[model samples]
Target chain A: MELTRRDAVAALAAVGATGGVAVGVRRMQDREGGEDAATDGASAGDPSDRDTNEGTVRATMVAVAEVVYPGEVDGIDEFVDRFLDGRLDGSAHASGLREAVGELADASQAWHDAPVEELPAAEREELLRGIGADTADEDPDGTTAERVRYYVVNDLLLALYASPTGGELVGIENPQGHPGGAESYQRGPP
Target chain B: MSGAESVGDGRSGGDGTTGDDVDRTPVPNADVCVVGAGPAGALVADRLAADREVVVLDAGPRFDPDDRLARRERAIRPAYDRPDVWDVGGERDAHENAGEWFYPLNHARVKGIGGSTLHWQGMVMRLHEDDFNSGTVRGVGPDWPIDYADLRPYYAEAERELGVAGGSGVDNPHAPPREEPHPMPAFEPSYSDSLFAEACEELGIDIHSVPNARNSEPYDDRSPCVGYGTCQPVCPSGAKYDATVHVDRAEAAGATVIDRAPVQYLDHDADRVTAAVYATPDGGEHRQEADAFVVAAGGVETPRLLLLSESEAYPDGLANSSGAVGRFFMDHLFAGAGGTLDEPTRQNHVGFYTSACDEFYDDADEERAPFKLEFFNYAGPSPVEMALSGDDWGDPLLERLRDGYGNHVAMGGLVEQLPRADSRITLDDDRVDDRGNPVPRIEWTVDDRALSTIERANEVQVAILEELGAEVEWVAGPDATGPAYHHMGTTRMSDDPAEGVVDPDCRTHDLENCWIASSSVFPTSGAMNPTLTIAALALRVGDGVDAWL
Candidate 1:
């Protein structure tokens, strides 16, 4: 069976995410990271992200996608989850995805009393904020930090913008998936 | 068409078995062999195909846009910016910047049948009259042998052919004289455009409608632009003018077009290119001889091909008698600024690059290089984008994405980069393209003159942003986009053989039968997009070759 869009490069864009938010709009990590102090997830040798199974990584990513895009990404989480656990074309830099998810889960468990996927929406948001704030200036030139950003934020955004719904948010219809043709100008966001 | 077979992407060889034995055997001679199936080569081949035999070749696939789309989907999972349809995915390294210059040339210019035109945003503009006299008047770079007057007619013709939508006698400062009106009126201005006009007006800056190649009202069998928001990387609809249309025209006019055929060498005897040799995907060679040859293989590939076509007659390279084949390189000095505006402006999200101002070139700067600013109504550093800065994710992320997603507006400019002998393209010793040919290594820089210009642009951007009550989010340095997409001036034209590679007619001084129809022959990089000029020159070069033939 053919791999779905969400399972394809949207998952592989974890490689791109590890670098920065990509597809040319904004790849550079930003400043003004809002972080909350670590309370629970902090542990010796990073005990927060202990579950390194492929399933945990995929589940964490689905939850993370919801956090990144909110209500806009409700229906497409499964395919993205499949893509994260599946193979990717020219996926040169996604090796750290599992570790990245584990890090997020570790942070979630440390801050909350559960893994990242099991954390409450509000807590997940708070944990992601803390991680982003912590990562804003950390590893100014390192790949590990970039990988973290990817696991938490960039990959989800990549998947969102690459999808038909995402393209609609940006005003592109009848794109590569369908036969090419013109439509009435989309004046504003739906 | 001309006894030369037309080969599509699939019909061509695949990997080691890329070429069939029949194709590998000697092919019949074409009257004119045009390298590159992009706009320039396609225009040349189309102009010559009616009377003279022509054959076109491109290093990328030549599937219908729809077919290519299907193939891309079936091959890779769906994603934005998937460039397998256009990007050569091989040896062409981005760019190597040396010296104190901090420019990173990671700009995307394609190598497909339509070249970078497939991904163009359709902001077409002609070079100013003074652009031809930079060498004589500004003493910044070499002057063109022919002036704006010589190119004016061809510009009109090209505008008509490309369906340029622009105002007639809008009386903009710093624009070249036009003999005829634009084929179509300017596209409707966005709400952001009106706001920008008001804001810039308060600061005494004038913004005008930019000429675009996208159809305003269905011209040239192409549909009008439906404002498919994402224009870069690829235009989903055929509304935006790309070279694929002209390539189709060339084929319809009885010219054989070959895809996935990379020209390896040009067989020459002293001053004449006898045949053009190309490599197949399966590691085989296919030679196509022609009475005439036009090298329109884009700025990078055109020069690289010349350097690669080295023989005993010209060890340095073919058409390198003056050693000017790959020197004097230039791209527009690009820089921009963007931030969140005080209020929501969804027009910024829905429109095209429909506005521009050349106030930077309105009054010439004797101290620094001249620049022309273009405004992007759709400029963005969206709230969702800024959320990556670690500000928020859940409710906060939605809030930010909703707040400033459409409220951002920005302006960027292309400053005229004066041609310099030191800023050149030399063959890289180590890196080889997918075809195993040595790629061109660019040694580019911006002097203090350009730095000052950039500093001024930053000031202007800040002023405009502040005028609109927008907070400054990000400011790119002098060369914001690195080298940008407008690659020009490598195989520059000059009447003097010692100082230039091609003549005023775009004929290589070293070889009379060879003509350069690409922007590679630009003597100076104008402060605007170069596609219209490239097409005009290709049409001119087509005439020159036709007359010579």
Candidate 2:
């Protein structure tokens, strides 16, 4: 249960992530947890009332993906980034996501003295559970915990199981959309 | 009327050409002009194109077969959001629900060249012998003018044409008599079907391989099913048969197919249709004159067209002297039962149903209607969708998915609804589609007899689930059931001209040269899927039209 940068990499390897995908995951993780952005949370104006932009949303989502995705899941950051690339269009869904992530960031800053992305992985998990996101019914226009469950936690899990690598870890080589061909379906699991 | 202006909303064609870029050249006169490029029109056009000049006019665009992968992706990523993945929406596909029970007409149909077959589940079942002799056998619905004996050869030919895959003739206990086996070998049942078969064996219910138009092996130069599991919305692989195959064949055999040309109305004299007036994407209208005319515009649209073509000669509507243009609208209601099993059923791995029980199909009487019970292969929660919608995350989410995803099982039934005079499609006076044509008003009603039949079906489904030691979560009775979208019985067929729209040959009773090739000519809504029967009847109509010419 030890949370480290190596743990994330090992998780990616466990799901048989390709080297290219593993590298992409590392790049996304570095972009979020770089020294400059880590200090920006502390140096910025009132963290609880900070501006909620696409950068904050992406960083918060990456942090959330680390907690929600299974330990066996590979390439969490890159997979999430790619999934969010299509989802975070300037639609109402994107706006709701930004608002929800901002709420989580505000709570982390007010209670734990740091942004959600700046907090340790255990504290981030503790913060999410403390706000009742673990048991809240997902609602876009409801409580802060409900919105976090809807946009952040569920979104990460959706991206994981829907991905080919993560789906194979659960013995679903071909999920709903991916074509596994007739032979794959006709034969029982090995 | 229903044909012309309603389909000219400037949508892009399947081949990536916009409607505005369509060739506006006047189509030359033809030996036969077929409206609606669905299975019915495609078959008739393909049949007649060899020796005669055939022109097919469709209200929708032709879809490119190559673009199915992208369409499949859309079905997967936003699975819940986009039910109509074929771009079947907007004002062009609008309608009014006049019935107490809201009938989702637009959701049920696609106006493209392949018609609803573009997204149909590909289950092709022939009507039982009792289905043809319903009135004489059970005194419920009217008897079909032509019996199963008359359609036997055509059904065989249609099976060959559509490349149906099924078990031997001896497999199904209630199967109608057929000479040859299915064209291709049958697809094996899903893992879940084996579990259901165990329970059905105890209850004396017979389970047989479902006859489907999808390929088990490569046939007719199309790929076999690749198991995308998005068969309902989009079949990324061309394994499932759609009407586009016949449409392409018709074109290859020298038929002139005009996509995105919605017919306004037919120009006719007292006895025969002379020309079909259709609209282009531009505000221009042109008439395609022909020696004969065939309307294959499906149940809802075909009736709407006839009703829209009201004139002085035929005051009721064109070829509607019998006043039976849209009198007997019918559809099959779906009855379902599902629950959680302790063992893994491994559901949702395969998309389409592979096993069915037709034992109750011949049991129609005054008490209960005929029905086909299907073992659903795609029942239960999808791992991704279920995990995302839950209130848990991380390891707890994985635990919930492991416990919930593979242990779900369900069974579905297609219960037949008898034809009622009031359950009909009429043109709405107030509401109009995008083209300013009066939309088709669907007035559907389920009587006590149909409700009782649904209850009977639910009982059987629930019994099977109980036998499997399932938790018995939900049962869909009459109130919870909805239509399976097998539109039939409108513009029904009758031997006597006074009682029906088309005669035995599917020719209009009043018009000398007008014919209908769609399932709209069906007299009864059989408990089976209607595509095979539609194909057989369409081919019969083609031969009849050819001989008449």
Assign candidate 1 its CAPRI class.
Answer: incorrect
Clashing pairs in 2: B3-B262, B3-B263, B4-B262, B4-B263, B4-B264, B14-B62, B14-B63, B14-B64
Whole-model lDDT per candidate? 0.66, 0.78
Number of the top TM-score candidate = 2
Q: Taking the candidates one at a time, how many backbone clashes does each contain? A: 9, 8
* Predictions' DockQ, in order: 0.08, 0.20
- Please report the candidate that would top DockQ against the real structure: 2
Residues B1-549 of candidate 2 have per-residue lDDT tens digits of 000011122266434455467674445768999999999999999999999999999888776654564455344432233534567777777788888678888778888789989888999989999999988898788899899999999999999999999985668878999999999988888887888889999988899898989999999999898776778867767889989899989989999898878888899998999898888878788899999999999999999888888899988888887888887888899999999887767667667988999988888986678999999987787776676565567777777777666677889999888888899899888988778899888898877888899999988999899988898899999889899988888888998999999999999999999999998999988889999999999999999999999
Cα lDDT of model 1 by residue, A151-179, tens digit:
44654654454444553444432222222
Candidate 1 runs further than 4 Å off: A1-190, B1-27, B67-85, B92-106, B171-173, B347-351, B382-397, B479-481
Which 10-residue span in candidate 1 chain B carries the lowest summed lDDT?
B1-10
- Candidate 2: residue B184 lDDT (0-100): 91
Ten residues in sequence with the least summed lDDT for candidate 1 chain A? A35-44
Residue lDDT tens for model 1, B228-319: 34455445556678887888888788888877688889999998999889876667788889888999988777888899999999999999
Q: What tier of docking accuracy does candidate 2 attain?
A: incorrect
